[model samples]
Target: MKLGIVRCAQTEEVCPGSKDFQALREKTGVFAKVDDAIELVGFTTCGGCPGKKAVFRAKSLVAAGADTIAFASCITKGTPIGYPCPFAKRMIAAVEGNVEEGVEVLDYTHGW
Candidate 1:
């Protein structure tokens, strides 16, 4: 599975996404469910709070060869900030609508 990661722009400054990358490398977290060989198709942000550009970014990632769009833990689990995105559900729905059917959307990259 080719994966695209969307992180939180605010978290980007404080976190390096080490846990997310580690989970992908070790097949932990959501990666454990991926039976196929995973590829790092893309890694980017949600365009800050409210995630205004997530839909476009998702489309871009899919176009760039990602079969799956994985929201980074910083967006879902919140991680170091301890506060998940308030717009996560709506943003996810928007992305799901923008992507083609069968393109998997994961709620998180790594949860910790």
Candidate 2:
């Protein structure tokens, strides 16, 4: 399964997202439970508040062949530092609305 990851821009300086990438590579959390091998297609931010940029980013990922969009645990679960994204829900909705049918939008890429 080709997947795209969306992370919190606020945590970019504090977290490099190495753990999230490692978890995804190791097939941890939901990835481990899935049957197919997960391929990372793209990684990007929600483009700050209101997440207006996320819709386009998601569409771009889908266009790049990402069949699933996974919101990194930093945005949803708040791993490591416990600072979750405030606009996660809205960002998710925008991505969901933009992506095509059958493209899975996962709330989290890994667990805390």
Candidate 3:
């Protein structure tokens, strides 16, 4: 399955996302449960605060052939930073509601 990753804009400065990408490529952590080979179709931020851009980004990823949209641990689980996005739930919900039914939404990309 092809996937897209969404992260918090604030975390972008400090986190290069190499760990998350590596985990996905290695099928480790949260990606271990997947049986099929996963491809990264997109990697982007929520455009900051309120995360209104999540919907648009998810849709864009889906259009680019991503079947799954995974929220990075930085936003959902807050690995490394120790502070998750307070609006993560709402942003995830909005992206879920806006995307097509076949598109899958994951709460996190990789584990700490």
Candidate with the greatest TM-score versus the true structure: 1
Question: Which model, 2 or 3, shows the larger lDDT?
Answer: 3
In candidate 1, what are the lDDT values of residues 61-87, reduced to their tens digit? Answer: 999999999999888888979999999
The lDDT values for all models are 0.91, 0.84, 0.91
Query: What TM-score against the true fold does each predicted structure earn?
Result: 0.96, 0.91, 0.96
What lDDT is obtained when candidate 3 is compared to the true structure? 0.91
Candidate 2 Cα misplacement greater than 4 A, ranges: none
Runs off by more than 4 Å, candidate 3? none
Cα-lDDT of candidate 2: 0.84
Per-residue lDDT, model 3, residue 29, is 73
Residues 1-112, model 2: lDDT tens digits:
9999888877888888887788788888768787788889999988777577888888888999999998888888877679777888888987888789999999987775
Candidate 1 Cα errors over 4 Å, as ranges: none
